[model samples]
Target chain A: MMRVLVVLAVVFATLPGVIVVLASLTAGQSLAFPPQGLSLRWYEVIFADPDFRDALLTSLTLATITSLLAVSLSALAAISIVRYRSRATALIEAMLLSPLAVPHIVIGIGILQLYGYFGLRADLLTLTLGHLIITIPFALRMLITSLAGMDRQIEHAAASLGATPRAILFQVILPQMKMGLLGAAISVFILSFDDVALTVFLVQPGYTTVPIMLFGMAENQVLPSIHAASVILLLASWLGVILIDRLIGFDRFLFRDGPSG
Target chain B: MQVAPAIRSSRLSRRATSLLLLAPTTLLYLTVYLGGLVMVLVMSIDVPPGVDSGGATLAHYRDVFGSAPIGAIVLRTLRDSLATVAGCLLLGVPVARYITASASRWKGIVLMAVLSPLMVSAIGRIFGWIALFGPGSVIADGLTALFGGKPTGLLYTEAAIIIGLTNLLLPFMVLSVASSRAHFEEDMSKAALSLGATPLSVLLQVELPLIFPGILSGALIVFSLSTTNFVTAALLGGSGRDLVGYEIYLDILVYFQQGRGAALAMLLLVVVVALMALAIQTGVQRHEVRDTAARTRGT
Candidate 1:
């Protein structure tokens, strides 16, 4: 009975993804599972469409910049959280994770208002800020988790050898946190890449992310090309998960609660 | 115990450097993130210019809560959130136990499989459901053939929303359960079995109590996550439903009702924060227990 339930759980978990892969292969104009005939025609169509092309570029670029910023900023904050023993450190840690407590839809519109008040256009910068607000928490949490379990002996050894702070940081601390850094980088990039709620209100029409664009298309009409778009995203996310498992080990990182907490 | 090498610099300079290290993150979080949050709260109560006399009123809250449909919407949101969490816990506990008990290399592969829905965007996975629940799809078609009735009512319903949210949340639930089991592994169960207790009794009496906190926090997390999501509820659930998430989206973008949207957003924020506080408090309590234990040992 126990084994049966685990099998069932795994099956249900991947069922939607499997259905998507099958649906995307359809030769039909509209979306449907169990395609009439398997074809790559829809994939070709989605790639040709400038909107999908631009949205893909915009999403990747936004994710890249957001993850880069999130990793560095959170690395600094994680040092404070792990290294220091100050009252303010706890406050900072709590505040950094505060965004996870609130709903993303609220943050999305709040960001819209923030930019609107300052007369800032809803472009890449605004989108990056929105993603940053969401992604920073994950980056901070991952680094904090990594730093917490780390042994301090190596840092002490380096300092006792008269190594400079910069050397110890670059060569000792960072190299130790490599897996954590990569995991943070991958998680933040994926979260920022696939964000829809934050992207929806913070995006300009032509400069929107892929999820936002796909959402609009999903809302307006059903198309097999959207399935193709989804299949590509699913594939991309699968690659990230695989990389996470290889680089750091998914069992180590992912068992912590998701960024939702 | 600072990680950086302590230089022989003056006290004030060390303080300044500490401030410098902390300043960037503090400034960004406060100015950009918290500032937006405050803006939303301000917009919620202070009615936009054209709507009313506009003197820091609770009129938006009064307007939102006074309406009958809003009440119904809140109830529906609650129902869906509860149902989704229930579904996730039902499925998640067994899987988490399986992962925790097994020492095989393939357990990592299984963990990845569990998180597949979560790592995939809600939009991507939900679109797949649009296919799965769509007419003439395999599941729908299979049902139609067997039952000899129209294959409908599943798509664009609360059922679909619940299923989508449950799948998205199952990984978290599994992780939480797995985390609790990590500290108390197979030893307890083995000890209980050695005492001649039945397998069923050992699981119920020995293990369930240990992992109950995990289940509680996981349920709360799922409740909070599923309730606040707009995209999954919107696309999978048709526009006819007045989900708080979808309604807030329409309120802000469609009707240009910023005040009401902000009010609704704040309400959702309050509920989500309260649940998260409980969840974190559970975690913090355990950490405090460990800290006190270490302190006692040191003394």
Candidate 2:
């Protein structure tokens, strides 16, 4: 009975993704199951469209920048919080991680209101700011874990060996945290790339991210090209997952710390 | 005593260095995230015509609470979220048990395959549902042939939203349960079996009680996620069936009523956080009790 339930649940959980991939391969004009013929015409179509291309470019650029910024910021914060052990460390960490507790939609609204209040325009900078709030927590948590798990003896030994702080950071600390930094970067990229709820509010007219564009398509008219775009995103995200598996082991990263994004 | 001054200076320098390291990100969060949330709270109660011109008012809250349509939407959100939680529990427990209990070589691969859907964007996954639940779709056709009636579709219905949400969040449930199951004692089950307890009885009487905290936490996550989910509900529930999040979207984006939107958002946030705090409180207390019981048993 348990076996049957697991099978059913797996199917229920995975059927949508499988269907989406299949539907993206439809040779016919519209999306349908059991495609009239199988082809990559939809992928070609979406790729050829300038708007989709622009959105894709924007999402990639945004994800790259956001992830880099978030990881770098978090790497610094992790160092301080783990090494300093100040009374305010817990509160500061919680403040950084509070985005996970708030809904993305609320974050969007809050940021939108903040922009309006501050007279900030809804541009890539502001959008990156919003993504930072969402992505920072994930990066921070991963880095903190890696930092906490590291052997303090090694750092002490480096210090006693007449190593400078910069030398310790560059030669000792970063080399050990290469996997954590890489994993955090990949995870944050995926989160930023897939983010829609917050990105929707941040985008001004004619400036849509890939997920937001797909969201608009889903609401108005879901072309097979939308499915194609989705397939592209899925593949990109899977590529990230594979990289993490190679680097840090997927199960250890995922189950050990809960959901990535 | 000779090194005391040097140690104090090093401590001061360490404090300064740590502060320097943490300053930029801390400042950014303070300005944007903390500042933005405070703005939302202020906007929710601020009277119209201007933020600076008016005293704080509860008109938006009153509007949200007193409106019948908004009430109905809230009720629907709660009902669907609860149903999604129930569905996840039913499917998630068995899958989690399978993951934890199986010693197969393919365990990691199977787990990855089961969870890979979480990597896909929500819009992508929902588009697949749009295909499956549409008229003349595979599900509709299968049901028609099986039941011998007109084709039935679940598109744009409450059931569709429930299914979509359950699928979207099942990974979290599985992760939670499997993590908890990692620490489960195999000896207790073996001991129960040796005492002539049926497998089903052992599962129900011993295992479920032990893992109840996992289930509770999973339910809380699923419930909170589904309730605040804008994408699935927006896509599956369609127009006029907006969840609270979607309703807030319409109010702020479409209708341009920031006050009402802020009010609704705050209400949703407060309720979800309150439930989480309450559940986590009980969950932690229960975990402590369980640990104490296990210690006593060990002694």
Listed models, DockQ each: 0.57, 0.57
Q: Where does candidate 2 stray beyond 4 Å?
A: A257-261, B50-53, B143-152, B279-290, B293-297
Q: Write the per-residue lDDT of candidate 1 for residues A1-261, one digit (tens) a residue.
A: 877888888888988898888889998875767787989998999999998899899888988998888898888788777876467778878888998888989888888888889999877787887788898888888898888889999999999999987798789988888888889988888898888887788887767888888889986867799999998888888888889878866776675532122
Fraction of native contacts under 8 Å reproduced by each candidate:
0.67, 0.61
What is the lDDT of every predicted structure here? 0.82, 0.85
The local lDDT score (0 to 100) that residue B217 gets in candidate 1 is 83
Error of 1 at A63 (Å): 0.9
Q: For every model shown, what is its TM-score relative to the native structure?
A: 0.93, 0.95
Point to the candidate with the largest TM-score.
Answer: 2
lDDT of 2 at A108: 88
Question: How many angstroms is residue A220 displaced in model 1 relative to the true structure, after the best TM-score fit?
Answer: 1.5
List the per-model TM-score of the A chain: 0.95, 0.94
What i-RMS does every model get? Answer: 3.2, 3.0
